[model samples]
Target: MGMTRLLRQPFSHPALPSVSFASRTIIVTGANVGLGHAAAAHFVRLGATRVIATCRSESKCAATLAGIEEAAGRKGVVQVWELDYSSYASVQAFCARADAELDRLDAVVLNAGVATRIYEVAEEDESSLTVNVVSTTLLAALLLPVLRRSADRFSSENNLTVISSEVHQWAKFPERDEANIFGSMSDPKTKTMAERYPASKLLQVFAIREIAARTHDSTPFVTVNMVSPGLNKTSLTRSTKGLEAAVIKIVNALLAWEPDVGARTLVHGVVAGRASHGVLLDHCELENDALAPWIETDEGRRLQRKVWAELERKLEAIRPGCVAAMEGKEA
Candidate 1:
């Protein structure tokens, strides 16, 4: 039984499909390093007409393009776009650029995220909450219209995948009971450094579920889903130190897959088809039941709705009418 459980956990190289991405456009966030870098190169090698690799710094562009060239053994198909997830303005601006510049958008992998041991804040919330939950979902809401338009123009369902993790299953989420959940999360008194990353991922699961539910009956559909690539050896833990980092280093050596190997699951997710709508994909397989058991309960469902309403208000503040725009409704 122990061996069975261990094997069931996602590890080893995930299979990549033989399908062509020719004439398709893909956007990968944080593509200058780690899994995002590997996935962007995979898209290029797989024949995508345009692969936009977004990073936080402009200085990273040339190096990122060079890395992609070396990995894909190809150049010119990839463009490095500056996108700072720390700023809502940057998120909005990136979407606007995509709207004006791209003829079509086939898929987006929301792979940019952080794992920090510090209690830093950005955009009025905790840094992880801001980047992984708010700005990430805000970007998703704003880009829905673009994805919808692409769906209609190309007569295909475009994918928008949030890179999630199994750690969410372990998140105690002490803030779930608060009337203003996000507000509670923003308070330093409620902060737990060890649990912050997992909680952020849990919030992402909740937000993505709400987005999927709202868009379920809408027209010109885009397939919205969350994916867990499992643990991979990446620089995501570069910020950690001391015993935590030491433990992580040991565990990574024992179980983590390489970024390029883990990246195949990310590529599989973007083209997972309409059936993947509003669900979690684990190891390139559907795993709706794998969501935290609490998420399916009555209280959990209520919290999900509450979070959705609150998040829409937050998104409205960031980009007026974006929530409504996401649902294909007039603001």
Candidate 2:
């Protein structure tokens, strides 16, 4: 069956008028499920010319594609691409393929991530940092040209929206001993998996800010911003069982919103609107107070520089060509 025929429900928003994606091309990572899937479906439904629903496996993407097409009311509107964020080689390969297939990328939602799992290292010497932070940083660097191309074609509103989380508030500044993000996992005194997950998310916020700053002066039209989706029910939370689930249920009932509702901020960040470059948004609203204190800190800048340098070194080791492509080139 074709994909569009399967979608039956249209996304609803009482506050903001429904927006369409006609003629735009959006790349949604981890699009096989959860907020990624919802965002992909919403874009296709709004008339996006091309929606790349990227996932780690094609076989696993079938249901997502089907659901997206159904939601969009068209066949073949959503296309699946393989992207294993944990593998530097895979990330490079995906970029090469994306460059060939797409002349422009209107928006790239870096939505793929992991949580509540055992510590693991990606291809690069970095821990899961390679996957969650390094890979995302490199991908944006590589795709800036395409995003700029799209901005040239569109108005000044085109942007790159990064999916971040509120967990960023809890991240510790990168320390000498914690260079390897997973190093703490080995410590018996380490905090829970939930805490570690939030720390990684915090790194992403800094990465987004750095990328935004790097690109703003040159390509003001192509803004970059971070979006924090408040807690929602998704596969990432599947690890919650028994008492954990009960606690989550209670907490969610009090604070968490639906997946589509949570995705609103990301969607708003990408669409033409009042959003500013280098800003962090929460629930479709700019987070001035939340991000202001961190951005003003010397510690934040130091951590940003350290992480950026380390990621650059790791990427170069894994894919010299990609590093060379982004070197000295203004995104």
lDDT of 1 by residue, 207-253 (tens): 99999999998898899998888778899989888898999898788
1-331 per-residue lDDT for model 2 (tens digits)? 1113112113323144278777888999998878888888778767888999898976887777888788668877888888998777788788888888887678888888877555445663334465667788778777766677667766535667777776666655334247644344334355345466666777777777877776656643577777766566677766657898788677666555566666665677786343567877765666434463664588668777766666666666666655444432622
Runs in model 2 lying further than 4 Å from the true structure: 1-17, 125-127, 153-157, 173-194, 272-275, 321-331
lDDT of 1: 0.87
How well does each candidate superpose onto the true structure, as a TM-score?
0.96, 0.84
Mind sharing the TM-score for model 1? Answer: 0.96
Q: Local distance difference test, per candidate? A: 0.87, 0.68
Model 1, position 321: C-alpha lDDT score: 87
Model 2's TM-score against the true structure: 0.84
Which consecutive 10 residues in model 2 have the weakest lDDT in total?
A: 1-10
